[model samples]
Structure formats: C-alpha cells, structure tokens
Target: MFTQDSKRALTAAALILATLTCGCAFESSPRGELGADQDLLKTCDPAAPPASFVQIDGTGSSNSDAIAAERMTAVEAIARRTAVCSGYLRVTVFSSSSAATAVLFDGALKMDGATENARLKRVPEAVSDVMNKVRSAYAPAVQALPQSGSDITAQLRLAAEWKQQLGGNYCLDLTVFSDGFQNIGVDLGARALSRQEAERLAEQPAVPKLAGASVVVAGLGRVAEGAPPSAVVEGLVSYYTKLCQRTEASSCTAVSDYATATR
Candidate 1:
C-alpha cells in the first residue's frame, strides 16, 4: 500500500526512535551509571578535607594486647567518622625524635556521589579497605616492644608541622594514645606535679604551637609497669591539660579510655 521511498523513510524513523529509547534506559538504570558516578569521586577536593591525626606511643608501655585492641577499635571508629565527610586520616607511631617517627597509615575518604544510593553502595567498601590497611600498618607496632623512649612533645610538634603544611582553614583533630609518661625530656613521671608546676612546665619553648587544634590524650594514666598512685595519675592529667592550653588548643581532653575521648 505504500511507495518504496515512503517505506524506506518509515524504516529510518523507527531505527532512530529505538536508539533514543535505549539511551534513555541506560541513563536511568543504576547499573549502567554506577561507573560514571564512581569516577566523579576521583576528582574530590583534597586540600579542604577535615584532617585527623593519631599518634600511638610505640614504647614498651603501650604494647599490650588489650591496649592494641582498644587502639584498633578507636581507629576504626575514627575512620568511619572521617569517611562520612570525605576527610583525611593519618596514623603514626611515636619516636623520641619527631624526624624518626614512622607513619603507619595515611588516606583520604572518597565518596561516589552525594546521593544516598551512591553512599550506601560505595562507602562501606571504601571504609573496609581503609580498616584493612590500618590493621596491616599497626601489626608491627604490637609485635614487639619498641626500644625508643616516649617523647610526647616531639609527636605534638610533628603534628603541628603537618597542620601547617596543610595550609588551610581545615580543622585538625589530634588523638594521642599514650600513658603520659614522658621520658625523653621534662620527665613527667618524676613526681606528682601541682597544677601550678604543670602550667609552668608547659610554658617552656619546647612545647609545640597547636593553635586552633583540638587535642585528646587517651589512656593517660594506664602505664605498663609500676602504675602510679592516684596523685600521680591526677598530675599526669593536669600536665596534659596545661600543656594543651599552653599550645593554644581549642579544646583539651585527657581521659583514661578512648570511649570518653570524644570532642
């Protein structure tokens, strides 16, 4: 009933309509667009991410299994929190000299997209990878007791330097896992210090400049051996509080456990 030229034009229009329908379907399907959404995370802003630094004391005191387990749990929690906002998290082991300190883990959380579907599908896998790396990096620290003395100040200084290097208005959250027994300099374990003495000691030039940073000193009184009396434990807390204040920290919390170290 139709002419040959008319039939040919009708066939061409059908083919074009089919192609457009396929394209539309592909765009609307989750499976088809997941790859493209993932690719977007690769270009996320690096400099503006909130920064978190954790310094674990690798000295003999913090080498026990219980402490290691607690540290791992705390680090996992921090990783999860950081991932929610696509922030940066760094873990390091303390050394007597800041220059000699070892970096355990350094990573930035990546998000596929702002949509809930993208977050649910991608964030869990990313967080799992981060925890795996953190566990791997932390293995060697608990294998054997470190020979080096604990230098809490040096680690703080190193963190301050890192924050400076970041060079932005990004907030820095510092968590220190230690027994608060400084043996390298200005011995904190020598005697129970009064609040005034602690403040005076923190005024020394050796203290790091941590202006605008929030600091949490966890496991402050849980030493490996010769556990100090209540007075000494109180002294340790006071010393760290004064020290954080001296460095101009935004907030300071010296607590005995990671569960209570939240800002």
Candidate 2:
C-alpha cells in the first residue's frame, strides 16, 4: 500500500528507465547504427566517397623490383579509407607466371563519422598483413607461374568478375599498382607498345565491366627491368583514363604519388 505521491514517483522513474533503455538499444542495434553510419558517409566528397568493393591489383609493378614503398603506402590508405562497413577488399598479385587474390578484410568496418580515424589506423596494419602474406606464401606458391610478362587487361577483367559475383548494390574501387606496361596478353604482339602506339591505341574504346565503379591508377610511371619506358607510362595513364570514361566510372586518374593523390 503506497501513498498516491509515492506511486506517482515510482511510475515516473519507470517511464524514464524505459525511455533510456530504448534509446540505448536503438544506438547499439546493428541496423540502427548502420543507417546512421551511412548517413555520415554521404557527407564525404563524391569523388572520394566510401566504397563497397575495393580491388587491389598487385602485378609486376607492385610485387617485383618496381615495388615502391611510398606508392604501396598510398595505395594502402586508399583501400582502407574507401572501405565502408559491410564492404569487401580483394587484393591480387599477378605475374605472367601466376596470380593470387585474397580477401584481406571483409565485413562491416564501421566507416561512419568518428570511426574514420580508427579505420585509417587499421588500414596500414591490414596492408602490412596482406603484403606479408604476398611475400611469404602467395609469391612462393606462384613462383612457377611461368612469366608471360604483365597482362593487365586480364587482371582488370578478373577484378570485374569478382565484383560482379557480389551480386548486389556496391560502389567499386579498383586500384592498380603497376608500371603501366602490359605486354604479355596485349594485342600489340609480343613486343611492348611504344608511347606513340599506346596513345593511338588508348583512343579506342576499352571499357571494363565493373559497371559504375571508380578507378585509381597509381605507380604508373615506375621503370624496372623489362618495364615500359617513362613515355609509355604517360600513354598508359591516358589509356586507363579513357577506359574509365567510356565505362562511366565515378572517378579515374593516374596519381604520381598516392599520398599526394589522396590529399
């Protein structure tokens, strides 16, 4: 038997507790938080918007002698920053001899708002893990792959295929770390394309099937043994740019430095 005033106070306390519990549950619910996170990502620049699928192409330029630490760091940043929660990252290293691609990080990464810093910090470590695996296991297993030289078109096609298999709404980000000299599977015959020839060829339509995904072509100007000349790099950039344009990519550009490009 409680006094009326005492009962009223208890009722008020109950209501307050219920309200707080509901609020906390909403904030912690996976669906509720995902919606909130997506809203935050919308504020990002359209050019640098969050990604649904990020594919890293590690070919001759990325794994071989041309592998530049600076460029790799930049690429790692792009892959990490663009990766949104519930997205996927696929890293592939290919040579004429063999190829290997793996999902380095998969699932929701919580790319909204304050999580950006955490995501950024996570990217470098993720890249290191992937690269370590590449150097140790992937490279060794594929050592006998029989070097056919660099076959870039095939790599892009593979990336597109992997993205398509996801089978849903996704913003694709394709980052190619390469020296931009593709010869093995190119139609120009066994000989690499000269800068002049590459320019003329780049004018032709070479659209990828990644739908509306954007592309970032970095490390395009590196030179290595059997790599394309510096002039060829310029032509390759133009070629990829045209390809991206024809495919209606969100954005596409060849960056000299990954760090500078992202900034």
The per-candidate count of clashes, in order, stands at 0, 5
Tens-place lDDT digits, model 1, residues 1-263? 86653453344323211221101101122444344334433333344455778888877765677677667766765565456547678888775667646777887665666784667367668768877877787767544434567778877888898888876555677888888875476777788888788777766747787766677777776766555777877878888878777787776777554432121
* C-alpha lDDT of all candidate models, in order: 0.65, 0.48
Scanning candidate 1 in windows of ten residues, the lowest lDDT window is 19-28
C-alpha positional error of residue 59 in candidate 2 after TM-score superposition, expressed in Å:
5.2
lDDT against true structure, model 1: 0.65
Best by the TM-score measure? 1
Best by lDDT: 1
Flag clash pairs in model 1: none
What's the TM-score of every candidate structure?
Answer: 0.74, 0.58
